[model samples]
Target chain A: MGGSLNINHLLFLGHGALWTIGLSVIALVGGGLAGFLVALGRVSPSRTLRLLAATYVQLIQGTPLLVIMFLSFFGLAAIGFNISPLAAAGASMTIFVAAYLGEIWRGCIEAVPRPQWEAAEGLALSRSQRMVKVILPQAIRIATPPTVGFMVQIVKNTSLASVVGFVELTRSGQIINNSMFEPFLIYSIIAVVYFSLCYPLSRLSRRLERTALQKKPALA
Target chain B: MGLELDFSVVLDRWRSLLDGATLTLQLAFIAVVCGGIIGVFGAIGRRGGNPLVERLCGAYVEGIRNTPLLVQIFLVYFGLSSLGLKFSAFTVAAVALTINVGAYTTEIMRAGFDSIVKGQIEAAEGLGLSKAQIYWHVIIWPGIERVYPALTSQFVLLMLASSVTSQISAEELTAVANYIQSETYRSFETYIVVALIYVALSFVMRFGFWLLSLALFPRRRRLGTPL
Candidate 1:
């Protein structure tokens, strides 16, 4: 086996990294939209809604993303629906990310203090107004550091998308490794690329967390 | 797809699914115990007086944390074959997860350690307490109690992350699902069932951790409050 690193390999990796970014955005945006609903559901006026959302979170959190991916890709086929790898991975990531983001956002919403909810309710605001105008705006600030920290997790976790043949950075590395049979070198480079992508977000998240802790004496 | 769904074929393998879930729990249980020890030592090592020790500990945490667990498993499983060590998939998966979770535990424990006031240590010292005694009574227990929730969540995540070991053919729940799907041609039903099992398993783990917390931290029960 050849142990060579070349321009073409670098180009392939670059392409893979771009796909990784694309997929992360898809997961975040798609998940974010669905998660907002779940978060609202979690704190809904209706007990049934809250219970349903809680069940959703519990079920999704209990399962692994890898299994979700398999379910999306192979499961769809087994059910007589033909789907692409992008569909499978994106769908899996969305479902997985929604549960986590829902829980995160739910905590943020609840962290806005009981008084704020009372004040908004006393102001004759509707349920929607209390959320959109009062609670969510405040909750987002509380949610920032953890959300950013979770971004690092999302990026690293895209590596799992490779298992379903999504051809992201990790899978691209696996492809090269198969040809070169250089597990150590290829995987190390891939790891470095992932570290470069993740470490900045990690540092930023920690910094934001520290700053928030200092300023927000009323932190939940 | 407009479709009727079927689970009978998948349900036929319930025995295997139960075994797989049991295996997953066993793997996570072993990793948590092994990793908790490493985490405690790693936490102590980070705060130890030796500069080399601190650097060594820091590097270990960062090296393991920054990389993906899948790669870590590959490294432990395949990367070791290059170095002439042969280990079972179960061992490799457990070792990799232990290493992965230990780094996170070290980070969490460090935060807990930092929360302990200097006055408490001084009080321990003023009472003629030795370093070991101070660590046990003043440092370790309180620190662990403070971060117990975070630690339990991490362990729960580890239980989920154990699914990655399917790649190494670790006969865990995900792996068993893989095999069953191939055999039964019921990938959807198989994964759905396996996913349900994981949900139940995680709930059980969380409940068990909650019980362990109440038992281990007397302050939790006596005070009826968090430490």
Candidate 2:
């Protein structure tokens, strides 16, 4: 046991890493769709719709993701709905990611120059055409960097899913640490693995942010 | 889909939840202050031009930025104890949180510091002002003012993140809720109430930061926004 590191341990960690990526994808895609709606709602013509979306964003963004996981896990059960860990984690992540992403996209949408909106309206484009062809096309450029930046947050946050008994990377690391009694080695490796996954995205996001800043006027 | 919801069990433990939320806010408030000090120092160290200090600051910022808070908590709490260094869970939790937030605060402040116009600093220097005076008047205060919103948001995020301390059994909000749930066997009601409380705490934190900004930066409050 001392001489050779356990291949099985390595294998289990590898599997957990894959699930971490899987959970991230689920959160990202699901969150992106929900966020799109939230973003639209934030900019909706109706004041109630805008306020409803803003409240949703504020409530979700203020609370920690871990609490959301708990509510989704146990709250669903208490109301007598049978739920799985996957559904709980996935649902919680969707809501959690949507809040932040929606805000991010909202900023992007609003950042589209006022004149451009006027020009689109002047051109007699339909509302949908104004959004898709004129507005969203421009907002996507402003949104790319922060959107990618939040992805790193999403990946890091998925670690919290472990507490609800979803055995992702951190949970698997805890399991291994429990047996091997190697807190330093196990957590160090876990941190390194996380670093490896997140560092590139961090660098890329910063680069995007810098380039975006150079091109766009600062928005308060 | 077909069950009764009862708040009585959790409501009986209202005092416990209140204290927990109080502890959570206190932790966040203390960490923001302490971490701001560290962040300012780290920013200076990175820009200080001393090779070793710069490298050390860079590594510290990157290291903390890259790892998950849960692992950082473990290394500080369990790993250190394994290596014969001993401390209470609360101390370890605070230390870990401070270190984590300090790095983020460092990066945010660095951006603010970098954006200060060269002309302003040169003007301070041309007035026979000492470097320390120049930094205090021109750099630190204004930097904090410019990045006030970003810093407040990060601190709020830190407040939310204090939940991770439950992993170390630090008796913070999430930990208190955990204990209440175990005692009351009202897991759903407990978490729902706690979630709402966290939402309330964040709103309060935002209001507090806004008030503090007014007191700290009268120029900003009077003048149009700086950033």
Candidate 3:
């Protein structure tokens, strides 16, 4: 076993933390684009589109993310495609996040008061035009705080990517602990680093929620 | 070349998979019960306990919420062992899961508590209800009923999360899958079956919780509204 945790170990962990942040960003952006489509699909005019989207959400939401990751990793290999840990983790995260964000954004979209949609229709705006110009603008505002809060879940969940041998923060800590044999100390540092990364987002989410709550009163 | 898919090898290990699934449900059930208790009391502390207790509860919630369950699991696994305490992996997993979910449950319970109308509590007080009676009649039951949906979803998520405890070798479903996959060389099919099992488990739990809410709050059943 390595004698003790050193500056080098800390630096190694710092690198892993950066990767974790990178994975979170990739998951968010990729998931956001697909999730936006899923959200729109759920509320689309066509019943087929709505059923398809709803089925997709149900299937993903019903399964654990770890299984998704394993399926992506091994499933890809079984099909004869060489997959890197990054690609596997990123792809699975996109699928997982899309389902959840789709659900959340769909709620925000539906939360727009019925009167708003009726007013837009009353003005002779096409459905697409009405959505882009009116409904989405309002929905985006309502979706922000919860979206930010979900980011924390995204960050925490990315630790699972370590299971795919992705060498994120959690995996980095495991590597260090393997040699150091000081699981408590190494893992504690790992937890603290995660807390530092996530707690501010949590606080910001709560703050945004409070402001949103306050604004609702004045809006009413 | 055409790719072939097979499930026979994995299916042959059904007995072990069933055992693992049972352990997972048991672990989740224990954690939910213990965690639910912690959550109710912790919510109370945050809402009306002494300021010090309030701050500690707040910190506990924030600390656990911000970090990952994976890290929390590791900490619990290693932290306890460092103190020279020897316990089974199952015990450790359940304890860690309980502590982790308790914080989340506390937050949900707090929201439930907040949704209780002030006038209702006052009504309870004006009716000469004792403090404990006010807590039960005015605060706790109705609050939980309001947040029951949130609690159900969280508990389902908790069950899925228990798969992570397998990392510490807890002998849960994921761990069983890992072993079978390695042995059968059927990683993809193994995980697929396990995933289906999890989805099934979630559906079962959802239905169970619905039935539970029906039995727990008969007033809601009768009126179709919060009591």
Best by TM-score: 3
lDDT of 3 by residue, A151-195 (tens): 999999999999999999999999988887889888889999999
Q: Write the per-residue lDDT of candidate 3 for residues B10-90, one digit (tens) a residue.
A: 899999999999999999999999999999999999998599999999999999999999999999988899999989999
lDDT of 1 by residue, B1-227 (tens): 47877899889888998899889999999999999988989999999889999999998887777778987887787778888898888988999899999999998898888789999999999999999999999999999999999999999999999999999899999999999999988899999898888888888999999999988998779978853
Once model 2 is optimally superposed onto the true structure by TM-score, how far is the C-alpha of residue A62 displaced, in angstroms? 1.4
- Steric clash pairs (candidate 2): none
Chain A (alone) TM-scores for all candidate structures:
0.96, 0.94, 0.97
For this target, which candidate reaches the highest DockQ against the unseen true structure?
3
Model 2 chain A is weakest, by summed lDDT over 10 consecutive residues, at A1-10
lDDT of 1 by residue, A43-98 (tens): 99899999999999988998999989999999989889889999998988889889
Q: Is candidate 1 or candidate 2 better by DockQ?
A: 1
- For residues A51-164, write the lDDT of model 2, one tens digit per residue: 999999989988999899988887777677769888899999999999999999999999898988888999999989999998998899989999988898988999999888
- Tens-place lDDT digits, model 2, residues B1-227: 45677889898888988888888887887889899999999988888789999899998998888778988888888777988988888888889999999999998888888878999999999998998998889998888888989998999999999999999998889999889888877788999899999999998998999999889999877886753
- Looking at model 2, residue A111 earns an lDDT score of 89
DockQ of all candidate complexes: 0.72, 0.69, 0.77
True contacts kept of each: 0.78, 0.70, 0.72
